[model samples]
Target: MSAERTGVQTRITDVAALAGVSIGTASKALNGTGQLRDSTRQRVKDAAEKLGFVGDARARALSSGRTYTVGMITTDSFGRFTIPVLLGAEDALSAGQMAVLLCDTRDDHVREAHYLRSLAARGVDGVIVTGRSADARLPIDVSMPVVYAFTPSTDEADVSITLDDAAGSALVARHVRSLGRQRIAVVTGPERHRSAVRRADGASSVLGSHLVAPPLFGEWSERWGRQAVDVLARQAPDVDAIVCGSDQIARGVCDRLRESGRSVPGDVAVTGFDDWDVMALASRPPLTTVDLRLEELGRVAGQALLALIDGGMAASASVAPTLVIRESTVGA
Candidate 1:
């Protein structure tokens, strides 16, 4: 008999009976808990769907002593980076039927503290802290499981999911070298910034003696990229390639290079980090750039947070960067 015909509420036991699994296994599969085979979990889920079964949240909460909700705290007011992370996290958490509460502190310490307290009061199972930059920030003092994303926690013991920036820079350096570009230059953001410094160092490690001049440090803007061309003209007039710290800077460099009568790839190849589509696609010849895979990082962070909530240990890890080849480095 169909559950709708009898107007009887379907239970996990009914789902288990239909799926030929024990009630315990059905419960674990539905709740996204316990160790079960993927096929077993999927079969149980299919049975539950066929039976139109839905678990009672109140009873489940009482049994588990968990609210089944998590908090996502971000300091990125612009949502430029946080949005993708949030989307990926949502995807991961949906499998567990867990809810997420988003809190944006806008880089205000006092505001952040308030959100932390609020999340604790709401009885979130855990929290994921993130920011726009890769610079490490102080760890949150919450008693719940905490996972850091993008911007890591200063404490080494905390779980942090970050991008492999140095490796990404090395990829760009190697690609330009493969194109037979001998004289290369680097242009990036502020010297004090960890991301800029790491990227420059990574490229330098690969280019070595082939690097034409010291990396130019300035703001992360097209204006700085345009200005860098002037400096490179004076220092390495015959430079054949430029590795930029960001897509915006690379676009600017391309613009300035065009103005200076240097044909891209034919005369000088260009590469950028952060495959930001708007900047990379709009550039004259497009940009060959590094994909930070921020969404994947977020998904990993979400999984780590979930593991912590489930009494599993999660270690700090980094996602490898992906090099995207475009017309900027290779002529069309």
Candidate 2:
């Protein structure tokens, strides 16, 4: 080797020599890819670790033309409905042996555009758009494989896995109906939200022939919850069951119903979505809700992106959502 080549400081070649493998093999194994045997991969990893060799991600990306880093663009920061999803996506990506770059736009179109473009510029292998209750109209066309989890973009060409609002809402209605509550009411978010509309449709379908006032529409906030309860009280005093779009709204409904001297399941039953009691799991009277399978959505999104990266075909897929019954909606 030339003097200049001999003076290179990379330990990858050293690690490869120790592992009895080619430098390219060491590179692939350490970078978490290639068709190497399991034992060879482990040996390469161990040797690299022992030699304190960190594979250069950029060089690997350049050689393979694959960045191996996935980006996630969230409309909101981690919240009641989104934390599980973020955690799940993180877990899934980590298991895939890929790095994550997170961007929070807080539902701003301009900021979202900036982040999306920035991620694209960085050469992310794929992107997962997470948890936006509003319509997502990204300004630029993304060149990377894109997956939408817990939220769908306005463009139908993008892949997505969202909570089955119809299924969740129907579950709540069925539970309330099982409790024999003849009068039902709904407190949901803005009418423009696709989720809110689907949940309402699901509830209406399941509560056939029952008396339900027009749904009280508002933001997904505890304040809206409190205000909506008051409005419902005046507008539909005879409501026997109330299904909230979210756990926060349900908490507001429960608090107001209690203050108004209504016994849960006796006078009015309440239910929520996103299994809101992740905070108060130890509480005696916890909330009832729907498990939107947020993390599972992450797993599916990651799998789809990986498949896309592998040049495998993928059809638009759906994940199942489940309901968790708790004291909030059950009888006395």
Give each model a TM-score: 0.88, 0.79
lDDT by residue for model 2 over 135-244, one digit each (tens)? 45542368767777776667677777666788888888898888788988888888888878888888888887784687777987767877887898788888888888
Kindly state the number of residue pairs that clash in model 1. Answer: 0
The TM-score that candidate 1 achieves is 0.88
Instruction: Give lDDT per model, in order.
Output: 0.92, 0.77
lDDT of 1 by residue, 55-90 (tens): 787778778899899999999973777778888888
Q: Which ranges in model 1 have alpha carbons more than 4 Å from their true place?
A: 1-47
Clashing pairs in 2: none
- The local distance difference test score of model 1 is 0.92
Error of 1 at 27 (Å): 8.8
Candidate 2 residues lying further than 4 Å off, grouped into runs, are 1-54, 78-80, 106-110, 134-136, 227-236, 278-285
- Candidate 1, pairs of clashing residues: none
